[model samples]
Target: MQRDRNQIIQAENSLLASYAVRQDETGVREYPEAEHPYRIPLQRDRDRVVHSSAFKRLQYKTQVFVYSVGENYRNRLTHTLEVAGISRTMATALGLNSLLAETIALAHDLGHTPFGHAGQDMLSDLMKDFGGFEHNKQSLRIVTFLETRYPSFPGLNLCGETIKGMMKHGGEYLGSHLGQERKEEGPSLEAQCADVADEIAYTSHDIDDGLEMGYLKLEELSDLHLWSDSFLKVKEEYPDLGGKVLVRSVIRELTNGMVSNMIRTIESRIHQWKISSRADLNFHFQEGKRIATYEPEYWEKVRELKSFLYRTLYRHPSVVVTSDRGRDIIESLFYHFRKQPDSIPETYRQRFETEGLERCVCDFVAGMTDRYAEEMAQSIGFKSKEA
Candidate 1:
């Protein structure tokens, strides 16, 4: 006999720890629907996210560099995939819901603006009087209202837990879609894993990208405790490693060390607190205790590496020039649409009556890919800042 949804849930439950989210308790949706016969709720949520148009747009979105910078650089789509892979590995090791972790990771960056942080910061400043803009809230907005697919629902109508997990930066979302109630409780172990996974993927991969782009040097990075430790280990293991292979090997070792240390640290916390159920986890969460984190000494090294990247890679002239162009495109588009709302797609134009013109314009601009935004800006008679 074929395994049905109930059988699958049972299997999942058997594998999950007491503190992990139970499959049965999840899947509460805004628009109620019948459960699938074969797939569990989280699996269905993952599929819905994967199928959404917003997810597809990530392919052209920036991660650290603009999409046009290079074919091999990590775009938002590749970064999301890497986060999902790392989160899944961490969740499985901790006996948490790996599927939930992966789903959250997949949907985490669906609302990132075209030029990464540069676009987001510009949009935020432009919209400051209009309630401001943040990617996390934008992500929630996309899944809840922006994405119009189903005839019965305006959004994907993903599971409640999936939505909550996607709110990695926890705070109050102003819109009625998420309500005004302040969420004080911490997220589940799966959500924490996904959040940290994002950190690990970006920190290590950004180093690789910096090296590849010639913006960062190996000698400069050797001063970082985290990089040096990993570099030494990689060099000891592969005596002849050089060039791209050497960089990749070092990054792999760095990633591996971070993941292993994070898992071990979280496991130690779980035992130290004697957390054996969801209720126990909630109790600690209510007490403002963080269950998932690296040891302080190790975390200091990670922070050092991040600070180095911020100073060296992110502030590089080539990257700044590209990001500045992207910001100009976004800002130009924002003003253009504000002046003539009709230029926006009819779908977004219709939102003007209900969500106000500025917000509708912001939503439309936020959804554009890097190249598309540039194209649209040119079509609107806007010139590059450098031009």
Candidate 2:
């Protein structure tokens, strides 16, 4: 005997907390369609995101290092997967909708430009007059108007909740593209899980990548409370641990510790706020209360770690040079297509009439992988031998 969609949804909802968004509230798509026979809306949304071209292109998009930096470094795709996994664990532990959390995590970075933040910063600077570039908003644009798979819909036609979460991912919601209905409710706990998962994934993995690249050393991280605490615990557990294996274990422990801390914090907050239902959560948000957070001291430590990474790893001379080259490639490509609109693909050129030439070009360039961007740059005589 197999359970149908209705039965499955009931069974799943039975386990969720009152504050969790119900599967039924996955909300409507921009374009209406028949529901799947077995899959709930959030699950269906996750499948659609997985199948999107933007998700696939994350393979070649940068996270912290250029794709050419090393095969071992985390690319955008890997980071997204890590975030999704962590979010599922956290959401499930908190009795929230794990599928919704995972879906948001997977789709969160869909709009990241090639070459990571470097590409995005350059694009933002160039588009300042037209409308500024934000990866979060770009992601919303991709799902809403850019992707052209369905005959009737221009974008993925994702659930309104998913779209809202994307825009709310990094506080980029400016009431520009989405309607008031979608923007009224604050971010769900599932969305909060994705946000924290993203931070945990990047912080831990950057440590791993930084160590691997010889850009960061264990000795340097000793002063950071998060690292130092996790390191000591790992060392105490495995006194004989040494070298790469030890470092990997420490990173794993760090990630685990952060997830556990978040779980505890959320649980504490729920009880303290007396949040028993969706309405309660919404009321809290309306009152300017936020749920997803670390304890004050822990958050300060996390902030300290972030500051350390920004100064020591992200701004390292080698990483900066590599990121600079990527910026140059994007800059050259942007101007090249702007000067010669015909140079962009015929599909994008068609969008120029409605989307405007600058936006159309921005979309085309934003969707490029590091490798493809370099190829486009080389075609126009922008030369660079470095990664």
Candidate 3:
């Protein structure tokens, strides 16, 4: 027996919470199309995001360490997968739309530039006189305007709900250019899950990467309450465990603790806010109350951990050197393309007539991976290849 789209949606609705965004409630897109027989709208949207060219480019983009740093370090693609896995787990535990959460997680970093945050910061500074650059807005641009998968539409033309989830994945909406209706309220619970999942995945994985790369010693993190508590528990269980095994166990425990706390806190918030339905969630959101969050105490700990990572791992001399080099490459590429607009591919060149030279150049440079950006910089004589 083959269950059609409606049947699948019905099953999904039955399993999800009242406050979860239903497939039937999605807004219409710029290009309307028929739904697939076997796939729900959100599922199709997830597939479209997975298949996008920008999604593929994520494999080579940096999460912290550049691609040339080592194959074992987390790149954008691995980070996206980690976020998706964590998001789906939280969404399922919270009785929200797991597929939407996963889709948003997968698409959230689709706009990240070549050397992680460093590349993004440089690009933003370069484009400051223009419209400025933000990865969230760039991710939206990739799905809505840049990706050319369909002959009928300019982009993937994903469901409105999925796009909404992506726009609000960071717990805030910055797509004011998307018009008034898209700026109605805070993100849905699914988007909230994805946002927290991003935080969890990066916080845990960056520590793992730092430890492996020798930038962060295990003893150094022993002082942080979150790490100390998790480390104590893991050590209790595996007394003989040391090295990578011990580190991995502690990271696992830390992530698990955070996810469990987030779920518990959100459940309490839902009850406190009287949010029994999606409408109620939206009402509370529009009223300037957030229904999804970690407990205040735990959130403070997370902030402390983040500060530690920023000082120790992110600002470590080796990482700083790479980031500085990456910034130089991005700046060089931006100026090179800005001067010789025709040097860019015809596809981007055509966009210059509509988006202006700087904006078009920004788009072209932003889409490049670490290796591509470095190679382009060398080719343009902006820097030596060995440099």
Candidate 4:
């Protein structure tokens, strides 16, 4: 269905991704039964993620606090839901591809290790000799191959478009040492839209979470750089909007500024970097290709917000100490069970014994819950409540 102007991003020319998850019309139609009763193509993407074992395990995965003695803190699952909400809202307003945006947001952290980035870093260090470890690529693996829904397909069989967008964070993928020449090029408009939405969601929500956790005060946050510019004007204009209002106002500004850059870059055609449209994701013009850059001041605002979170929310004493412990728990769990393999879960054991150990170990650690982490730790004598 063609989206209305106010709804999803509509492109008369928006081509489909290089592949699709359930592309075979005949196969989807005859897959043992029935029709999907949804209007959006990504609804299937959403359903698949929701039903997956990995998604359920997100309840134990850390966003900030890990090994929480209580259920009050935000887990990776809650964070993903928040990101989806904000991403959908921003995409709706910008007329970006909301379904694709939501899909990327939903799958962004599926590959995250047991303790989040801390866990990721440890695994990356351990797997340096291998292909290296990254949550984004892991998300793709989970959806496409690891999920056990279909016998014939190795993964959940997601289409190409959503997978592409989920991995392509910017117009490109910038990691450890990959320079301008070799970095995987940027994302489609759909993927780019999701990236922007992720920023908007996490920045605001993390601040809110920090305040709730007593790691930050509202007054202290007002000192952050985002308010140094036109914030007063926006506040006066939308006095009753509160945090929700402030978040939308700030996001709208950032998005508009960024989109303006994208338009200008595309039109000027002095492209130094390649941005993928429907036709090409990695094609760079030697003469007329460039990446979009936002205003420095605007960038400062974003940096300050991120820095504030790094200091007060993510790096806060409570958040850090707990996640540090969480790292030990996951690593210990992985090392111990990875040897026996069969002690973890029947499916995981079979997968490990069959598919090789690393991925199976990934699957086992990825499936644990918060309590399960503690329980495993206690059982292994790595941790004891009495300690």
Candidate 5:
């Protein structure tokens, strides 16, 4: 077919909805450069993200269980991949930019500190006196500042749309301090897809992992409306289904049900709100309304499932013990680096001079893998199996 960039962009524009973010309308990169000859802006942005060092580091970063917990649990990288896959499916079904959604989903967790949310929480508390630490902001920082790829730019020089997607992948604008123009509204349809996909991926996979680890029991989860419904459907389909097979079927059905509901609800909202254009969507968002959401009943089910996970799995004593140990390791590493800024790698030491001690230390700590963090902590006499 030999479609050039313009032709590919035109094809995409023709297929996408008016409310979908178009490649042609995307804002330029911070460091302006010539476009790729073959791939469109969003495609190139996705490639850059996939090829980045931070993206690779996600392999060893924690998602729920720490890396040392077991090989069977989902790590940060696997979670990101699942989110991207789900985002692409949702975006395609919604007639939005699937590539953009996938890019955002992949880059969404790039800033997550080692040891999952526990490490991030610890760092956030430590950096409260500074500007505060957040994975959303850190992801932006990695793409725009920390990752020095090309000689002309400090970051990957991704398109503004991709950066915006990353910033708003949580369904809200966290904050942008890189001098980029801030959006007054919520994320675009693609970003919103990525956001929901992140939720779907984690909720389902966490359930799978929890069950595998014996932290959560299927009998207990049956009380949740979402779980009960899926379980009943799977049981009805295969009356003899039992054990892991039944669990897998239920989880698959659960994810499928959520995705189907999300798509249907979004379509209904688009029609109800008369959102025929991107401007309409933006206006609704500016008015503090979401165009992308599940129906009320489905949303309630989601909430119930979340609450159950939090109560039974996330706050379980075993999980809490590991989380607390991770927190202590993060804190120890932060103070150690803060006191000896020169002890950081030369690359980061140079950043310390410009980004200040706290910011540099935070970046260095945030970039570490779970095993690396543990090793660093153990080097300084912190005693623990993981540390």
Candidate 6:
């Protein structure tokens, strides 16, 4: 059951080792190679990610709630863990690489700033010259340079498919779509799973978080097409399956829902557009064609859930105010420092000389825990130590 580099290398046209070559603000991944007797290749990949420092950093980074508000609200780390839980489940059910799915889930947001997307937007504007910025790509960078394991190497040395998801995980922002040619990497089925896995977790957890925070009533949450009734039925029948109990199964069910929806949307769109062949997911190279659809009624319910999260969970006044401030603070910091990375703190400065300024800046930001990043906002001259 044990598979190694030579084994995996022969299985694919190439294994993406270059990503493991970059250094984080700390310099290198500090992992030790171990000979496991019975772990599969992808499983090994998953384990490496969970053990990496960068993966641990996810805890301190942003999720829906800012890190400080509530200990329970998902932080980047918790979010990653949840994503992995659901991903492994899905991957296992589908007979894909459970480890690969889990690895991608854990590393998906490694590049997110201490403040989440708000922080990424700011850095992207500043680093537009340094090929811009991306959390997925940064996740790739984390395993490669910052995590520190392979003495002879810098990154986790993951597979090509894993790296591809890290590179192109979100929106179809093809190279140069936003002004620069996209990284010379293609999409893979694994990345697709990671992307879908994120959606599944976010949709379900945000509601759970909403309920936890007292913003959503269970009745409100369960008001969907069979979804609400089904959730209630499960709660009523199992009783014990309440709270975070069946979260994984719910997410698995949600994945099926979303996938089914996407299938219908694609099919309907194809017919509407007069397109032929089910090649939208061209890279998937699917063999058997299975019919899937998101029931219109269910779609409406999902939309309602999505809207509720946006308005209640994401757009809560307190959260919005802080996130808005977060956006401003991070943007200001990146703009000034991108021009003079030497302005970065001494620990970061010494590191800057090796990786150049932009990356050094990215490392400085990415390395921060939520509280520390907000506190350090002052050193860069973006307002004062006092908010």
Identify the runs in model 4 with alpha carbons over 4 angstroms from their true place. 1-41, 67-73, 169-186, 228-294, 384-387
**Tens digit of per-residue lDDT, candidate 1, span 34-94:** 8889999999899888999999999999988887778999999999999999999999999
**At residue 154, what lDDT does model 6 achieve?**
73
Model 2, span 178-236: residue lDDT tens: 54544567778888889989999999999899999999988999988999999999999
State the lDDT of candidate 5 residue by residue for 1-387, as single tens digits. 798999999988898988888879877888888877878988888988999999999999988898887898899999999999999999999889898999999999999999889999999999999889899889988998899778999988888878877765233343553233436545789888999999999999999999999999877998889999999999999999998999999999999999999999999999999998877887888887886789998899999999999998889998888899999999999999998888899888887667788999999999999999999998988875463
Kindly list the per-residue Cα lDDT of model 6 for residues 118-232, writing each as its tens digit. Answer: 7777777777887677776676667666666766667786544455546552344444222121132233334455666687678877766766777766565556553564465
- In candidate 4, what are the lDDT values of residues 1-387, reduced to their tens digit? 755432322232142332111222111311233334433345666677788888888878877666464467677898888777766655554445566667778887777777778777766665666456677777767876677886665666664566666664332344422223223434555555556656665666566556556787657667866643435656677767667567547545544444454445443432333333433434542233433334557667778778877877887777777777777777777788767766777776676546677777766665566677678878977962225
Native-to-model Cα distance after best TM-score fit, residue 329 in candidate 1, in Å: 1.1
Native-referenced Cα lDDT, model 3: 0.87
Per-model C-alpha lDDT, please?
0.89, 0.89, 0.87, 0.61, 0.88, 0.61
Angstrom error of the Cα, residue 209, model 3: value is: 0.1
Q: After TM-score superposition, what is the CA distance of residue 202 in candidate 5 from its true location, in Å?
A: 0.6
* Cα RMSD of predicted structure 1: 1.5
Estimate the TM-score of every prediction: 0.97, 0.96, 0.95, 0.72, 0.95, 0.70
The candidate 5 region of ten consecutive residues with least summed lDDT is 169-178
Model 2: lowest-lDDT 10 consecutive positions: 169-178
Q: Which candidate is the best by TM-score?
A: 1
- What 10-residue stretch in candidate 6 is worst by lDDT? 19-28
Candidate 1 clash pair list: none
Cα error of candidate 2 at position 222, Å: 1.6
**Clash totals in order:** 0, 0, 0, 19, 0, 22
C-alpha lDDT of residue 186 in model 3: 56
Lowest lDDT block of 10, candidate 3: 169-178
